[model samples]
Each structure stands twice: as C-alpha cells, then as structure tokens.
Target: MSGGVDSAVAAARAVEAGHEVVGVHLALSRMPGTLRTGSRGCCTVEDSMDAQRAANIMGIPYYVWDFSERFKLDVVDDFIAEYAAGRTPNPCMRCNEKIKFAALLEKAMALGFDAVCTGHYASILTDVDGNKQLHRAAAWAKDQSYVLGVLTADQINHSMFPLGATPTKAEVRKEAAERGFSVANKPDSYDICFIPDGDTKGWLGERVAPVTGDILDREGNTLGQHDGAVAFTVGQRKGLSIGTPAADGKPRFVLEVRPISNTVVVGPKEALAIKEIAGNKYTWAGLAPEHPEVEFACHVQIRAHADPVPAVAQVVSTTAVTGIDGTVELRIIPAEPLNGVAPGQTAVVYVGTRVLGQCTIDRTVSAVPVSTPEMIASASPVPVNA
Candidate 1:
C-alpha cells in the first residue's frame, strides 16, 4: 500500500472479503537526514507512517521492508543510464518488474502468503485451460496496463488487483471516505515519484557528470551549444538554444541525440516522420513469436499518452548477435503516421487490453534527402548505445 485512497480502500475490501491480509510497504529510500519530513512524494518517512496507520485501521498486520539499495541500482541507475545513452527509460515499468512483482512477490511467498494483492486498476483472470491472463481496468482513463505489460504469466497467477472493477477515481475516493480512510482527499501524484519537481534535465545533470556538446541543424551547420546531449529528447522543441531561424521560418524539431559525440541534431518537422520502428529487449507475456517469417498485426503504443496505432509486427534477428546477449527485434509499421516516436522507449503491444508483449525501440527508419546525409550520419548510428 502506498497510503493512497485506492490502496487503503483495497486493504479494507480484502479484509471485508475475509481473506487473511498483511500490508507490506517497501521502503525504496530514506532521506540523508538533511531533507525535511513531508517532502513531496511516496517512499518517504511520512508516507510509510500513513500506510501503517491505514493497515492498523483495517485491523491487519503491517511492516516496512527496506529495498532501497535494490531500487537505486535496478530502477534509478538504469533510468539515468538510459537517458545518458540518449534513450528514454520507463522507471515505472522497471519498478514493477524488479520490485513490486518480483521482489515483493518473492518476499510474500517466503512469508507463507498464498498471494500478493495491490490497488492497481488492472485485473488478472484465469481461462478455462487454467492459463492466466491480464485484463484492463474498469476505469478507462486511469488504466495502467501499458506500464504493467512487462509482467509474466507466473507473476499474474499469484497477483490480485482489488480495484480493477472500480470504474472511476471519484468512486474510489467515495469508497475510501465511507471506509473512514483519511487519505481520501489527498491529491494524486502526477509526476515521477523520485524527481518531485519534474525537472528531468536537472535531476540527470546532478546524478551524472555533464558533458558539453554542439547543437547542429539538418544541414550540419552548428546552431548553438548544449550543456549535454542527454538533456534533450527526440521531438522536443523547448529549451533548445538554436536561435537560428529555419529557411521556411517554421519551428525546428529534435531529430536525434548523440551520446558519444554529445551532440543534438535538429531538423524541420517533416524530417521527424518515421515509417518503421525496430525494438530490442522484447518480452512476450507467454508464447514467443517466430522470427523473420511469422508476422502479426496488433495495436502498438509508442508513448504512454499517445493513442494506440494499428500496426503489423515482424520478428527479426539482430545484425550483430553473439551467443551471450543474442537479441530479437520487432519491426512495427504503423498503419498511419506517428509524430514523435523516440528510440530507447518501450513499444507496448496489445490486443484490446490484453497485453501481447513489449519491446524497447532500437531504431527508427526514416527517409531523408541526400543533401542531408552529412547531418544524418553525424547524428550517431541507430541503437548505438541502447
């Protein structure tokens, strides 16, 4: 439980259902004794206390598990590394994969619990053949199946989402108020939990050493200088120091981010169009799709808020593959154009709300004029660092 209204109501519902419930809150970090209490987000000292209080109110046992070291190494460090390599990382997915389902489930099993339950909006159901499947939450707007798509069949088999049937955020708050939970009126967290101010560039700069680099136009002309290449992402138009006006007098878009040379490439809006995307680190929920031969069609989601686009998916072998880290790539051709597909982000595939699989974007295929060859070549090779 994160001491939120949903989790508090979930604990109450579990107890009302007569199932033995034990609330476990993983302590992801602790302040350095310098930061004050009630600081903005969860995993803080006060948040843990709120969880404990809710558990007590629900008349169940509660405890705080220290997983700070693992969280930092697995989630935080990986997030920083991905950005430094000029790719966007999904920390929520990482947290679910490494901490919530993996670590917390293992610890719960060791404690002799039959299953672990949470307040997530998604649901898990069993088919006639005894195979487990994930389903969408009743609340359409608050559905989080995209982030939770990385979960495997085994994890879903032992998980319970009590609030999956709850349709709206308003209803959740009402339930919590009826149950006498104090956090019903608490505001929901809107940004990344760790970085309270939502300053990704500032947070990354402080976490890792910054390197100076050049900002170049599509014609290979130096537009300006950037503090670090990792500070920008593809399709971003703000905070760019390129004061040079485009030939057409229109705005420019970030075409690429180069980590090795520490440079950012800018171009006209038309240069940002991509027809195909190749992804690595592919993870299917159950069966693995055959490579290079069998192609399937599904809805592919490139970003969290973007609408799912119809696409055909094909499995391809990596150009450079060895026995140790051999990778499988999934190629997606969107049925229509997508505006800002970024490399190093996840491409989550779904059949309705049933998560088919997910993969990390390794490359984007775009056609450019021969005159801009120098600019494209100078922008770092595709999937060089990811």
Candidate 2:
C-alpha cells in the first residue's frame, strides 16, 4: 500500500476477495520525512505509518521493506545520468520498471507470494492462450498505463491492479471513506517523489554543475547563452532569456541540448516537429507484434497523460555489434508530427486499449530540416571550460 486512499481501498478489495493479502510499503529513502508536504512527496515515514494503520484495520500482515539502496541506484542515479546526458527521462517509468515490478516482484515470488498487487490504474487481461496482457484502466482520466509500459510479459503475469475497473478516482476515495481509511481524504502525491519541493532544476543543478553555455540557432549562429545545458530541455521556451529575438520576431523553443559541447540550440517552434523516432532498447508487453520487418498500425504515447497518436511502427536491424548478431531498433512514424520529443523519453505503443509495447527513444527525425549543411559545419561550439 502507498498510504494513499486508492491503495488502501485496493487492499480492502483484495482482502474481501478471500485471498491472503500482505501490504508492503517500500522504504525508498534511508531518511524519509516524518510528515507529507501535502502530496508533494511520497514513500516518507508518514506514508509508511499510514500504510501500517490501514493494514492493521484490514487485519493483514504488513511490513516496510528497505529498498533504499536499490532505489537510489536504479531510479535516482539513473535519473541524474540521463539529465547529465542532456536527455529528459521519466523517473516514474524507471521506478515502475526497476523497483516496483522488477525488484519488489522478485522478492515477493521468493517469499511464496502469487502476485504483487498495487493501486495502479491499469488492468491485466488474460488472452485465450492464457497470456497476460496489460490494458488501460476504465478510468481514462486517471489512466497510468503509460508509466506501466515498462512491464514485460513475465512481470504482467504476476501483477494485479484492483483499481483498474473503477470508473473514477472519486469512487476509490468513496470506498476508502466507507472502509474508514484515514488516507481516504489524503492528498495524492505529485511531481518527482524524491524532490518534494518540485524544483527539479535546482535539484539537478547541484549534481550536474551548471556551466555557462552558448545558445545557438539551427543556422549555427549564436543567439544567446545559458548557465547550464542540463537545466534546459527540448521545447522549453519561458526561461531561455535569449535577449535577441528571432529575425522573424517570433519566440524560439529549445530544440536540443548538447552536454559535450555545452550548447543549447533554439529554433522556430516548427523545428520541434518530429516525423519519426527510433530506439534500440525496445520490449514487448506480452507478445511480439507480427511482421516485425513490416509496418504495423498503432498509437504512440510519449508522456503519461499525453493523448496517443495514430502511428505506424516496424522493427529494423542496424549495424552489427560485438557479441550480438546486430543492433535492432523499433521505429515509429506518426501520422502527424510529434512536437518536442527528445532522446531518453519512453514511447508507449497501444493497440486500442491494450498496451502493445514500448521503446526508449534514442533518435528523432525532424520534420523540418536546416537550410544548409555549410551553416551547421560553420557553427563552432563555445566551450564554457575554455
């Protein structure tokens, strides 16, 4: 249980179903805050206490598992690395992939548990062949399948989501209240759980060490400068502080961040449109799609709450790598251009309500191209260190 209304109600339902339920609250941090900052943080000491109280009411076994070290390595450190590489990553996606499903599920199975149930707003359905497939929850507004896209076939087999069929979050809250759960009215946590204050830039600044970098346009002309390339992300416009406006007198959006060159590239908003994205790291949710080499129709969602867009995808083999036969990548071509997509972002593929698979974007083909190659070659990087 997460010490939240949804999880408490989920535990209640699991118990009512006549199965032995054990509530395990993960101690993701060694030093957790005793009080919640009004839903700004989670996995705190307060959350663990709340979870234990709910478990007491349910008359089930409950324990706080110390997964702090693993969480730090898999989720927190990976987040910093991705940012330092100038790529925006979803820590929630990493948490679900590495911690909740991979690590926690491993421990549960070893302890003779049949499944690891949670309050995630997603569903697991068994097909005719008894293969488990991940699907979207009934509550569209609260759907969390995008984050759970990292689940593989094996993980989905041993996962349960009691809140999947609920029509709304209000229903979960009502059920919690009816069950006398103290967390019924508790505010839901938001933003990065580890960074409770929601100042991601400041938190990353301390680790990445911001350095003054040149901000350039597509034509390789210096437009402005920024304190740190890590602080900026693709499509950001508000804080560029580029004193010189575009020649067209239009606002520019961040097109790319080059950590190696310590450069931030800004361009017209249209330059943000991407026609295609491809990633070498890809996994199927249950079964691999048919005709791996041919294009298949699907919908691609880049963010948790973003609407899925109609697209076509295919698996292709790239240059050979050592040991491996050849590097393979999943490429998606959206019917309409995707705006502001960046490397390290997860793309969840869906066929109707069923999640087909996902990929970590490694590269993107821009819908708009630079005017000339000469300009790009001519633009020299201004190194902050030098």
Candidate 3:
C-alpha cells in the first residue's frame, strides 16, 4: 500500500469483497532526520505507518519490505543515464516495471498471496479467448494506463487495480473517511517520489558529473558556453546566453543536444518544428502490429502531458551501426508540425484510451532549411575549443 487514501480505500474494497487482504509497503530508503521513520511518500517510514494504520482499520496485517538497492539500480540509475544521453526518461514507468510489478509482485506471491492489488487507475480484463487486456480507468484524468502499459501479460494476470472503476479521487477519499481511516485527508504524491524536491537536473548533476561544452548555432558558429551538454534539452529557451537576436528578434530555441561532441545547437523558432520522429526500443502492450509499408494512422504522445496527436506510424529498417543496438526504428509523422519533439522522450501510441505501444525517440526530422546554400557556404566555420 502507498499510504495514500486511494490505496487505503482499495484495501477496504478488497475486504468488502470478502477477499483475504494483507498490505505490503516497500521501504525504498531512509529519509534525513528520521531514524527508521517513514516520510509522507511511499517507501518512507511514515508511509509504512500509514499503511499499517489502514490495514489495521480493515483488520488485516501489513509489513514493509526493503527494496532500496533494487530501486537505485533499476529506476534511479536509468533516469540519470537517459538524461546524460540527451533523452528524457520516465521513472514512473520504470518503477511500475521493476519495483511494483516485478519485484514486489514476486515477493507477494512467494508469501502466499493469491494476487497483488494497488491503487493504480487502470483495469485488466480477460477477453473471450482468456487473454488479458489492459483498459483505461473510469477516472480518465487520473488514469495511469500510460505508465502501466509496460506490464507484461504475466504481470497483468497477477495484478489488481481496485480503483480502476472508481469515479474520482474525491470518491476514494470519501470512502477512506467513511471507513474511519486516518489518512483520508492526505494529499496525493506527485513527480518522482525519491527526488522529493522534484529537482531532476540537480539530482542528476550530483550523481553524474556533467561535462561543460559549447553552444553553437545551425551554421556551426559558436554562440555561448554551456555548463554541460547534458543540462540542455531540445526546445529549452532559458539559460542560453546567446547575445545576438534572430532576424525577427524572436527568442532562440534549442534544436539539438549532441552528446558525442558535447555541443548544444541553437537556432530560430521555426527550426524546432519537426514533421517526423524516429524511435527505438519498441515495447508494446500486446503483439507488435504488422509493419505496414505505408504509414498507419495512430495517436502519438511524445510527452506524458502532451495531448495525443493524430499521426501515421511506419517501420524503418536501419543498417548495423557501430554502437546503436536496434535494427529497426518506428517512424511517426504527425498530422501537423509539432514543436519541441525531443530525443530520448517516449512516443506512446494509443488507440483511443488503450495504449498500443511505446518507443524512445531517437531524433526529429525538420523540413528543408530556410537559409540558402550559397549564404551558408560563404560563412566561415567557428571552432569550438574543447
């Protein structure tokens, strides 16, 4: 249990359904200024107490399991590494994959639990063929189907999301209160729980030493100095100290972040408009769809908060490269131009509310250059002294 009202209510629902229930809280790590004490978030000493309180209210047992090392290796390390490679990573997805379902679920099964349950706002149903399928929750706004889409069929069969049919967050809280749980008024947690302050860059900088680099324009002209190439991301407008203004006096946008050369490329706002994105490491909720020669229409979401945009997806084959591992790429062309489509972010494909699949964006392809070839040929190359 996550020590939240939702999970508490979920446990109550299971009890109301006449199922034997036991609460398990993962002890991720110790918080500062607390001796074996839990914080308000999951895995903290405080959270364990909260879970125990909920369990007691339902007359059930609760225990805390330490999974700090696994959390660091699986979730935290990958988060930092993805950012270092100029890609935005989703830690929630990793946590759901490694911690919640894989690690905790296994432990729960070993302890004699028939199935694991959580407060996730998604549902799992068996089709006519007895195959499990994940569906969106009744609370559309709070539905977490996107992150939970990474679950395998095996994991889905053994998991339960009791809040899947719940109408709203308020309803869960009301249930918790009516059941006499103490955590009914507790606020819902947001962002990465481990990084309590939500300073992703700060947390990454402390773990991985960022390398200082040069900021350059499209024509390879040295514009300014950046603290580190990893610090800048595509479409970032702040912190760039480019003195010169654009031809129309508009602010410059980060077009690319090159980790190989440790360079941040800046250009006009128009350069940020990308028509297509190529991605790798494809993960689908079910069987991979047939790779059609023509682009297949689908809804693509480049970022978590981004509204799913209508797009056509096609499979692109790639030759063996030196370090790149994937042999095939997923190409997505949005119905209209999209801005700030950064590499390293996920492109989650959806058929209505059901997530079809997801892949990591490798690069964005812009249209033809606005500047003339003769004008670019006349400019001298600016050297970036490493």
Candidate 4:
C-alpha cells in the first residue's frame, strides 16, 4: 500500500474477500523522511506509519521493502537519459514496467506469492481460452490503463487491481472513513514524488548543461534565443523570446528540439501534424490481430488523457537494426492531425476498451513535409511562455 486511501481500502477489500494478505510499502529512497518534500515525498517513515495503522486495522502483517537502488538505476536515471536524448518519457510507465512489475513481481513470486496486487484503476479479464487481457476501469476519469499498457501478457497474468471494479473515488473514501483509517482524508499526491515542486524545467536545468543557442522559425529565420535544446519539448507555445511577431499574427509552437545542434524549432501548429508513427521496443499484451504481423486496425492513445483514435499497427522487420528480428510500428491516422507526438512517449493500442499492446514512439512522419527551420546565429534566451 502507498498509504493512500485507495490502497488502504484495497487492502481492506482483499481481507474481506477471504484471501491471506500481507501489506507491503515500498521504500523507494535510501533517505526517506516524512518531510522529504514532493507530491508523495520520499522518506516514507510517516507513510509507513500510516500504512502500518491501516494494516493493523486490517489485521494483516506489514513490512517495508527497500528497492531504492534499483529504482534509481531503472527509473530515475532512465528518465534523465531520455531527456538528454531529446525525448520526453513517462517516468510512471517506467516505474510500472521496471520497478513494480518486472523487479518487484519477480521478488513476490520467489516469496511464494500468486500475484502482485495494487490500487491501480484498471481491470483484468480472463477469456474462456485462459487468455488474460487488460481493460480500462469503469471509472473513465480515473482510468490508468494507459500507463499499464506497457505490461506484457506475462506481466498481466501476475497482476491484480482491486480498485478496478470500484465505482468511484468518493465510495472508496467513504469506505476508508467507515473503516476508521486516518489516511481517508489525506490529500492526493499531485506532483512527481521526487520533484516536490513539480518544476521539471527547473530540475532539468540543474543537471543538463546549458548551451545557449538559436530559436528559429520554419523559414530558417531567427525568431529568438534558447538556453539549451533539452529545456524545451515539442508543442511548447511560449518562452521563445522572439521580439518580432509573425506577419499573419498566428501563434507559433515548438516543432522540434535538437540537442545535437542545440536548436529550438518553432512553426505553426499544422507543422506538428503527424500521420504515421514508427516505434521500437514494442510489447504485446496478448494475441496479435488476424494477419499476425501485418498492419491491422486498432485504437491508439498517444498520450495519457488524449482520446483514443483510429490507427493501424504492424510488426515490421528491419535489417539495419541488429539482434532484434523486427519492431512494432503504428500507422496512426488520428481523427484530427496529431500534434506533440514526441519520441520516447508511449503509444498504447487497444481494441474496444481492452489494452492490446504498446510501443515507445521513436519517429514520426508529418501528414505533409514541414519546412526545415532556419537557424539564428545568436543567443538571448527567455523562460518558456514568458
């Protein structure tokens, strides 16, 4: 349990179901203090106490597992690396994929556990043929299946989500309060646990060296200046300190971030319209579509909260990429042109509400060719949206 109302209530429900349950709280940091300062904070001592109190009420054993080392290497470092490579990554997905499911699940099995259960808002269904599939929770607003879309079929088989069937957060809170759990009224964590202020740009600035350079328009005209390519992302609309306004007065958006040349490229929103996205490191949840490896229709969600759109996904072979035989690619035709389809972001595929599979988007093809942005030869940077 994360010592949150949802998790505490989940534990209570598991006990009510007559299963032998033990509560575990992950100590994800080597230095955890109640005042660690973030969304959920770090030094889980106080959180552990809250968990212990809930475990006491549930009358189940509780323990704290230290996975700080593994979490840093797998999730934190990987996040920094992706940004340095000019890609935006979903750290929560990495935490789910590497820490929660892969590493933690392996440990659970060794300790003789049948499945790893959590408070994630998603449902798992088993077919008559024993095929397990992941689906969105009934509560659409709180659905988190998009992040869990990275799980493979094997991972799905070993997971459980007790809150999936729960109708609403209000109901969960009510139950927690009725059960006399103190965490029933705890404020929800809204920032990244490691980032107390949720200032991603400020945090990134400390680690990524600044290389002041040009911010340019589609026509190669210098619009403004930028501190470093890593500080910006695709689709960002503000902070380009370009004094000159466009002749047409249309707003500009970030078309791309190039770490190599330390360049920021801005253009009209249409330049960001992408028709096809090819991804590497694909994972499948269950059986492939009828054609097996050929392109097939499915609904694709590019970012969390983005509506699922019509698309086609296929397994494609590449002679250039050694070792791996092939990679999965999604040819997405969004209902409207897709903007901000960033590399390193996840593209989850679904059929109906069931999660079929997902891929880490690596490249995209615009609906039409976007002009190569012109470069500015000087520097006078400003904050984004400033």
Candidate 5:
C-alpha cells in the first residue's frame, strides 16, 4: 500500500473478501522526509505511518520492507542514465517496471502470497480462452493502464488491482472515510518522490558532470550554447538561449539532443511533427502474437493522460544500429500527426481499452520539409504499419 486513500480502500476490500491480507509498505528510499511537503510525493516516514495506521484499522499485520538498494539501482539510476543519454524517460513507469512489480511481486510470491494487489486504476479481464488480460479501468478518468503497460504476462497473472472496477476516485475516498482512515483527505503525490523540491534539472545537474556544448540549427549553424546536453530534451522550446528570432520570425523548438556530438538541434515547431516511430526494448503484457511481422490497427499512446490516438502498428525486423539482431522491433504510424514523441519514452499500443504491448521509442521519422544528411542517414527506413 502507498499510504493513500485508494490503497486503503483496496486493502479494506481485500480483507472483506474473507482472505487473510497482510499490508506491506515498501520503503523505496533510505532517506525520506518526515512529512510530505506537497501533493506530489510518497514513501516518506509520514506515509509509512499512515499505512501502518490503516493496517491497524483493518486489523491486519503490517510491515515495512526496505527495498531502497534495489530501487536506487533500478529506478533512480536508470533515470539518471537515460537523461545522460539525451533521452526523456518516465521514472514512475521505471519504478513500476523494476521495483513495484518485479522486486515486490517476486518477494511476495516467495513469502507465500497468492497475488500482489495494488490500487492502480486498471482492470484485469478473463479472455474468451480463459487467459487473463489487462484492461483499462471502469473509471475512465482515473485509468492508469498506460503506466502498467510494462507488466509481463507472468506479472499480470500474479497481480490484482482491487480498485480497477470502481466507478470513480470520489467513491474510493468516500469508502475510505466510512472506514475511518486518516489519509482519505491526503492529496495524491505527483512529483518525483525523491526530488521533493520538484527541481529535476537542478537535481540532475549536481549528479551528472556538466559538459558545455554548442546548440546548432538544421544547417549545422551554431545558434547558442548549452551547459550540458543532459539538461535538454527533444521538442523542448524553452531555455534554448538562441538570440534573435528566426528569419521568418517563428519560435524555434528543440528538435534533437545529440549527447555524443555535444550538439542541441533546434528547428521550427513543425519539425517535431513525426509520422512514424521505431522502438526497441519491447515489453508485452501477454504472449507474443502469432504473426510478428504483420501490421495491425491499434491506438497508440505516447504518454500518460494523453488520449490514445488512432494509429497502425506492427512488429518488424531491422538491422539498424538502434535495433538488436534477434530482438523484434515495433513500428508505429499514427493516423494523425504526433508531436514531442521522444527517444526513451514509451509508446504503448492498445486495441480499444485492452493493452497489446509497448516499446521504448528509439527513433522517429519527422514530417519536416528539410533535413541534413546526418538526419537522413541516422534514421532507418520506416516500415509502413498499414
């Protein structure tokens, strides 16, 4: 339990189902604040205490398990590494992938638990063939199926989301109030819990060695300079330090960040419009499809809370430097233009509300009119999804 209203209600429901439930609050960080300052944090001492109080109210056993070492190695280190590589990554998704599900679930199984339960707003469905499947929550507004898309088949099989079918978060809060839990009114955490100040750039700047680099335009012209390539992300418009407006008097956006070359590529906003995305490091919630090479119709979501857009996607083969020899590659062609899709960001595939699979975005085919020879050569040929 995360010491939130949703988890409290989920634990209540689980205990009410006549099964013996033990509450385990994961201590993610070794050093945590005594109290959360804002609505965007978790894993503090106050949060752990709240979970313990809820466990007492439910009359169940409670324990705090310290997974700080593993969390630092997987989630925290991965976040720094990805940024150093000049790619944007979702740390929450990494936490879910490496810690919450992989580490916690495996430990729970070894401790003799049937399934690891959570309060995620996503559902579990039984397919027609008796296989279990993951689906969006009934509460559409609160559905978090996008983040949980990284779960493997085995993890999905052993996981349970007690709050998945709930109508809304308000209902969960009301239930928590009725149960006399103190955290019913506690706000949700949004910022990176470890970075309580919410200054990600500042936090990273201290840890990563700074390297000065030149910011370049499409024709390899120096526009400005940046302190470090790790500070900028693709599609970012601010902090370019590029003096004077463009000849067309248009605002420039960050088209790319090449860490190796120590160059930040700047261009017009239209340059960020991408028609296709190629991805490696794929993860599926279930088994692979019968035909890996077939192009299939689906909705593609680039980030959480963004509506799933109509798109065609498929797994394909590639010999590009970004792809692996034996690893299957994902190719997505959105029916509409997509902007700000970045390398290292996840592209989750869906059919209606059911999640199909996901891939870590490796490259994109920009719809921009002009490109340098380097840009043309860097991207491999994109296979049409449909």
Candidate 6:
C-alpha cells in the first residue's frame, strides 16, 4: 500500500476476494522524513505507519521493504544521467519499470506470491490464447497506462490492478472510508517524490556542475549565454533572458540542448514542429505486430496525461553490413506534426485503449527546413531503415 486511499481500497478489495493479501510499503529513500510536508512528497516514515495501520484493519500481513539502494541506482541515478545527456526523462516510468515490476516482483515470486498487485489506474486483459495485454483504466481522467507502458509481456502476466474498473477516484476514496482506512481523505502525492523541494533545476545544478554555455540561433549566431545547457529543455520559452529580439519580432523557444557542445539552440516557435521520431531501444507490451516491418496505424503518446496522437509506426532493421544483422528501431510518423518532441522521451504506442508498445525517442525530424547548409548537415533527418 502507498499510504493513500487508492492503494488502501485496493488492498481491501483484494482481501474481500478471499485471497491472502500482503501490504508491502517500499522505503525508497535511505533517509526519509518522519512526516510528509502535506502531499508534496511520499515514501516517508509517516507513509509506512499509515500503510501498516491499513494492513491491520484489513487483517493482512504488512512489511516495509528497504529498496532504497536499488531505487537510488535505478531511478535517481538514471534521472541524473538523462539530464546530464540533455534528455528529459520521466522518473515515474523508471520507478515502475525497475523497482515495482522488476525488483519487487522478482522478490514476490521467490516468496511464493502469484502476482504483485498495485493501485495503478490500468488494467490487464487476457486474450483467447491466455496472453496478457495492458489496457487503460475505465477512468479515462485517471488513466496511468502511459507510465506502465514499460511493462513487458512477462511483467503483465504477474500484475494486477484492482482499481482499474473503477469509474472515478472518488469511488476509491469512498470505498477506503467505508473500510475504515485512515488515509481515506489523505491527499495524493505529486511531482518528483525524490526531489522533496520540487526545485528540479536547483537539485540538478548541484550534481551536474553547471557549466557556462552559449545560446545560438538557427544560423549558429550567438543570441545569448546560459549558465548550463543541462538546465534547459526543448520547447522551454522562459528564463532565456535574451536581450536581442528576434528579426521577426517573435518569441524564440529552446529548440535543442546540445550537452556535448555545451550549447543551447533557440529558434522561432514554428521550427519546433517535428514530423518524425525514431528510437533504437523499444519493447513490446504484450505481442509484437504481425508485420512490424510494414507501417501500421496507431496512436502515440509522449506524456502521461497528454492525448495520444494519430500516427503510423513501423519497425525496421539496421543491418551494419550486407549480410550482418544489427539492432532495429521503431519509427513513428504522426498524421499531424508534434511540437517540441525531444530525445529520451518515451513514446507509448496504442491501438485504441490497449497499449501495444513503447520506445525511447532517439532522434526527431524537424518539419521546418534548415536555414543554412551548416544547419542541414547538423540536424538532417536520418533514415529509419538505414
């Protein structure tokens, strides 16, 4: 249980179903606060106590697992690494992929548990052949399948979401109250839990060792300077502090952050439109497409709450030589252009409400043409099948 209404209610339902339920609260931080400051952070000492009280009410076993070291290595370190590489990453995605499903599930199975159930707003469906598939929850507004897109076929088989069929979060909260859960009215946590203060830029600045960098425009002309290229992300319009106005008298947005060059690129907002996105690292949620080599119609979602876009996607081989087979890549082309798409963002593919698969964006193709030869050579579109 997460010391929240949803998880407490989920545990209650699991117990009512006549199965032996055990409430496990993960200690993600090595050093956690005795009490949470409102709903700003989670996984603290108070959260564990709340979870234990709920478990007692349900008459189930409760245990606090110390996954602090593993969490630091997987989620926290990965966040730092991604930012250092100038790529925006979702830490929640990593937590679900590595901690909940991988480490926790692995230990559960070893301890004779059938599955690892959670309060995630997603569902698991079994096909005719008994193959498991991941689907969005009935509550569209509370759907969290995008974050669970990292789950593979094996992981989905051993996962359960009791709160999936609920029509709304209010229902979960009501159920928790009826079950005498102390956290029934407890507020939900938000933002990056690890960053208690919620100041991401300041948190990263300490570890990344911010270096002074140049801010350039499309023509490679210096517009201004930044304290650190790592602090900026694609499509960011604030804090540029550029004194010189654009020639067209329009606002400029961050087009790219080149960490290797310690440079930030700014351009007109229109230039942020991206036509194509491709990624080398990808995994199927359940089953691979019948003809992955050919383009297939689907919807692609980059953010947790963002609406999925109509798109066509395909998987193509990247053979190094004539007869030598190499890695493959998942290429997606949206029917309409996507604005501010960037590398390292996870793009989840969906066929209606069912999650097909997901890929980490490695590169993107700009819809606007390059202004100069130097620009074209630097940001040219790479063939997906090459």
Residue 230 displacement in candidate 5 (angstroms): 1.1
Candidates in order: C-alpha RMSD to true structure: 3.4, 4.9, 6.0, 5.9, 3.0, 3.1
Q: How does each model score on TM-score?
A: 0.90, 0.94, 0.87, 0.89, 0.95, 0.94
- After best superposition, candidate 3 residue 45: deviation in angstroms? 1.7
Question: In candidate 2, what are the lDDT values of residues 1-386, reduced to their tens digit?
Answer: 88888888888999999889999999998764657788798998899999999999999999999999999999999999989888888999999999999999999999999898999999999889888899999988999999999899899989999999999998888888888889988998999999989999999988888889899888878988899888998989999999987889999998888777989888899988989887777888988776778889999999998999999999876443212445677889999999989888999999999999998876776888888542111112111110
Candidate 2: Cα lDDT at 246:
84
In Å, residue 153's CA in model 1 sits off its true spot by 1.4
Q: Candidate 2 overall Cα lDDT vs. reference?
A: 0.86
List clash counts for every candidate, in order.
0, 0, 5, 6, 3, 0
Candidate 4 Cα deviation (angstroms), residue 183: 1.2
Model 1 weakest 10-residue run by lDDT: 377-386
Which of candidates 1 and 3 is the stronger one according to lDDT?
Answer: 1
TM value for model 4: 0.89
Which of the predicted structures, 2 or 3, would earn the higher lDDT when compared with the native?
2
Candidate 6 Cα misplacement greater than 4 A, ranges: 32-34, 318-325, 373-386
Candidate 3: minimum summed lDDT over ten consecutive residues — where?
A: 377-386
Q: Please, what's the RMSD in Å of model 3? A: 6.0
Worst 10 residues of 6 by lDDT: 374-383
Error of 5 at 316 (Å): 1.1
Model 4 lDDT at residue 159: 90
lDDT of 4 by residue, 44-154 (tens): 677778889999998999989988899889988898888887788888889899988988899989999888888889999987898989999999888889989888888
Which candidate wins on TM-score? 5
Candidate 6 lDDT by residue in tens digits, 1-386: 87888888888888988888999999999764657888988888998999999999988999999999999999999999988888888899999999999999999999999999999999998889888999999988999999999999899999989999999998888888888888989999998999988999999999999899899998889989999888898999999998999998999999888877888888999988988887767888998888888999999999998889999999876453112356677889999998888788899999999999998787777788776742211122233432
Q: Judged by TM-score relative to the true structure, which candidate is superior, 4 or 5?
A: 5
lDDT (Cα atoms) of all candidates against the true structure: 0.77, 0.86, 0.75, 0.77, 0.85, 0.87
